[model samples]
Target chain A: MSEPIKTDVVIVGAGPIGLFAVFELGLLDMKCHLIDILDKIGGQCAELYPEKPIYDIPGIPFTSAQGLVDALLQQIKPFNPLYHLNEMVETVEKIGDPLFRVTTDQGKVFEAKIVVIAAGGGSFQPKRPPIPGIEAYEGKSVHYAVRKMESFRDKRVLVVGGGDSALDWTLNLAPIASHLTLLHRRSEFRAAPDSVNKMMALVGDGKIDLVVGQVTALSGGDGQISKAMVKTNDGSAFEIACDALLPFFGLTMKLGPVANWGFELKNNELIPVDSAAFETSIPGIFAIGDINWYPGKLKLILSGFHEAALMAQKAYRYVYPEKRLVFQYTTSSTSLQKKLGVAPERPAAPARAAT
Target chain B: MVQITFIDSRGTARTVEGEAGSTVMETAIKNGVPEIEAECGGACACSTCHVYIEEAWREKVGEPSPMEEDMLDFAYNVQPNSRLSCQIKVREDLDGLIVRTPDRQA
Candidate 1:
């Protein structure tokens, strides 16, 4: 219920394209506030494939997913873009022409002149496991993702799935849990070998118990889990007593509230944008990155970069209708360099008198 | 150059020649073929460029990678011959390629 934070642009999604959009909008003297569902800045790059090598970036031969994110973070530091992580944008209302009010799931509101959706693949929602009556325990005992380790302290913790989140939370919460159990449908995990090794070591030391089974049911009272009925691959069923169940079943993308933002949509998901300014059906509202659709739209980061450049040009007119735009390349534009906090070259240091 | 024919949902077809070493999605975009939307530019990230390769040219275009297949899951009207046009590279042997786009991209 706090006062809505005001900015020139409100960018949804903190992916590499979103980050780059900050630089583009910043060069136009438009301050930005970026909102993302993930707790971190990088979207799939940092979350899904941080170390994965990406070979398609222009100008750079190759870079790791996270490396590109890190470079972009450094590049946008001069802009000082405000970040609102771990929050999903829930509502977008056009208050005026070229003015919008955006609200997040966390109750934070942002008022801006332009709303840019750089949301790659929309909002990432955790894939919930299929278990009868599990919905009642959600946000109480059965959690999809661990938000705080302190919440699991001195509690019976059962971590599920074979991904990195399962192994990570199991390792992190084992020391503090009254009893820790790691459960998965398969014996082999999709997590990193080192994390798997460390988890096995914990099992060896009796700090944790590894169960190869899937949760079929949850028995609890007053919206809290008391025990989990697990079914093993060998057709064996057993009950594991636990107070907290952490299921890391990976994430699925949802258009979320963005779908109802009053823009024309294709397939009831992505926003349809024009090729010129990447603007949606709504004026001053631009859609870039993977969340947008056009006749020749490409979901590549480089394509998003190009879209961001064009979006900023059109956005500048909306933010400053009277001011004429002068396009300039950063390689020779001193004002652009100044905006990026780069000092001018000192005339080749006067050659030091030929010393 | 490689000649590729794109068939729209309404059975309209457009034949265009694309330079070698570029992707089918890129070539289609450049030639203003409405079938392939190459949204993500030629990145295997979006399924907007989903297409059904002609049965005759299936062996030539080859199969999609597991990554590309995952993206195709989001595409509309995916068939057994479904492949992301972005993942299909233009080559000399890929001449006379024919593919049909879905009614709408998912």
Candidate 2:
């Protein structure tokens, strides 16, 4: 609400689908700004499976998940869409007919004539370890993210998970914490070799305790944790007395705040959009990609691309109601070619899902 | 086709037929076994398709690759016999394979 950055279209996600939307909107002379929860773009492609090979992306025979995202970034370069990374969209409210006020958890706000919900699978959030009664201790003695290291001074800390985040924090907090313990389900670590060596040295020096186990339960009162019940692979249970517990269980996609935004949801998961314009019940708001649900809808990247193209056609009307809309293919239209920064005489190469 | 039985955490067992080349995760998804999320669609990027291979079929299923072992670190309640169903290929020798799904996927 603090003098929102005005834009023609504010896309709620910067995933592959959202990135593609920028291109379609740009072809129609509409500037767009995109936002994503992850620190980096590409959403699941970058976070979950960057190296995995992806097939069935139209003409492209094969490309890695990251490869497709790179291609998309290159294709949308002409549009030069601004991306607000490491931010989560928290609220969306309608201010005027076909106009919306969108705000992010990072306090950035945007006022746009068109709001596109291209958020696929909602947003990636920290995965909570399914330990019994862990909720009561959260934000008191248990923390997912460390905002400041000074808070852990002179406290018994238990760090869980074998990934980089777990190893990184364990090494950083060991010196400050009264007694630190690194608990993992297995001996082999997913962290870098150098960090593992440093961790082992700490154990050798008796600076930290490395327990090969999983947290089964938490015992605490008034949101202050006192002890944690851990179970080893051999089914033996032991108690780790700790004031603070940090469990790094990676991330999972959830329907997050978008579920609260005024709209219709199918099965409380996907936004329901009509197939023609891929617009939800709300006017001037459109949804594309896997986040959208329609009758006989296939959750494929290609399907999302098709949805983006059709949604742009309807979105142009909202951004420019007085101007007559003309449909032009990038393959043949000189104006579309100019927008693509290509030679008008030679036809602009059609945008493949991934080059 | 090979037959696979998926036993949920509640002990409800569902048996279904799977093609020889498809993955156990795919078979569960095709049959609507209700446990395999397969969030990454058999890319082995997520642990949602995690299942504990029964003791009887442990040897035939084999050990997880080092890459898979790294990914298992993200799964919940991982046991000695745990394996990502997406990595388990359905085959003639693995007919009547029984696997148990954990209470939740991480």
Candidate 3:
């Protein structure tokens, strides 16, 4: 057994909610150990489409996922959370009163007074289309998304899907790709109206080709996509020569290691939790963010914020039962008031005339 | 609509109704089935949505993409039938298909 490191709290995920827990815990002068499967923090906010605009989150009227992550990082910078990235918590078990043991995949063990499961959507896995002989061209020409846009420059690219990502990438690659073809299973796109209009304009000018069909096969040798075979909605098949095939299909959320913890799930879907406290059936273990389920539950970033804040208060109470949380108010005298641009003398209190 | 059956590792059978055009992950998620965690929202980034198809459904579900296969290498309890549920789409002919979620997600 590896030597166990101890801490006040062990947060299971490093996403926005987990980071908020860390920030709150730090405010209370508590130590926290944050763990995540990804190499970076910000959870889904950082991992998902960073460039895409997110209008749902509160405070910022409109911010990209990456922008939100950057702002969150700045807020937690002072706390200096102990981050353990590129690691996944394999198992969590209650050992004693208000104490738990967390073990990682690498055989590392950690003992903590409390465990906060801020693992949003757990570990995200992208969905891939079922295409024959596509496996042989795994690393060669097939791709899920182009993290590096420069890679496909001057290349003949075929972008698939009717979603926003598909349209976004298609538009982005239009100028770079020597020949660009956009294929969708449906005639109408699910992308934003503006993007669809722009794509349509490009198609009208003969800048790109739009094909409504499903990719059936990939033809190439020595590990690269040389040509793509697509079947139209109407029993028609056509082969398009291409250097790269990019699929921008959307994603789905899954429950990871927590599935074995034996928490009751409604309809075997989301993990059920206490509606008031957001605690799972297991004491000292809680689920937050999109992974949680309850009566009147709203799965949103704003809702996760409320859940995280309330859970932190309850967690604090669990860790320190005797200590009463206190909010200190700083009182300023005349001298301090002057520095703050406040008048030295207080205005006369409103006359207390008998009503 | 496509009818699919998911048998959890604990041997609980759950039959879910899925649209022919949606991915298996979406079908399972919509029906409140506790399997596949399409963490990346079906973007083929995370492996929390790992599942093993029944021998009969393996050919029907087909093979996962290279990126998905690489991610499965990082999943817990990987098996020959192991596949990311988000990668498999539901079709009319895929009714009665069976899949088993792993004991753990990540």
Native-contact fraction for each model? 0.00, 0.90, 0.05
Error of 2 at A315 (Å): 1.0
Query: What DockQ does candidate 1 score?
Result: 0.05
Scored on chain A only, each candidate's TM-score is: 0.84, 0.94, 0.59
On residues A19-112, what C-alpha lDDT tens digit does candidate 1 reach at each position?
A: 9999999999999999999989999888766877888998899999999999999999999999999999899998987789999989999899
Q: Which candidate leads in TM-score?
A: 2
Clashing pairs in 2: none
Better of 1 and 2 by TM-score: 2
- DockQ by candidate, in order: 0.05, 0.79, 0.05
> Compared with the true structure, what per-residue lDDT tens digits does model 2 show for residues A264-286?
68899999999999999889899
Instruction: Kindly report the interface RMSD of candidate 1, rounded to 1 decimal.
Output: 8.2
DockQ-derived CAPRI band for the predicted complex in model 1 = incorrect
Go through the candidates in order and give each one's C-alpha lDDT: 0.86, 0.93, 0.78
What lDDT tens digits, residue by residue, belong to model 3 across residues A148-175?
8888999999998876788899999999
| Model 2: CA > 4 A from native | A344-355
Per-candidate count of clashing residue pairs (backbone under 3 Å): 10, 0, 23
Interface RMSD of 2: 1.0
**What is the Cα-based TM-score of model 1?**
0.69
Give every collision pair in model 1: A297-B38, A297-B39, A298-B38, A298-B39, A298-B40, A298-B41, A299-B39, A299-B40, A299-B41, A300-B40
Off by over 4 Å in 1: A147-156, A162-164, A171-179, A186-208, A219-226, A346-355, B1-106
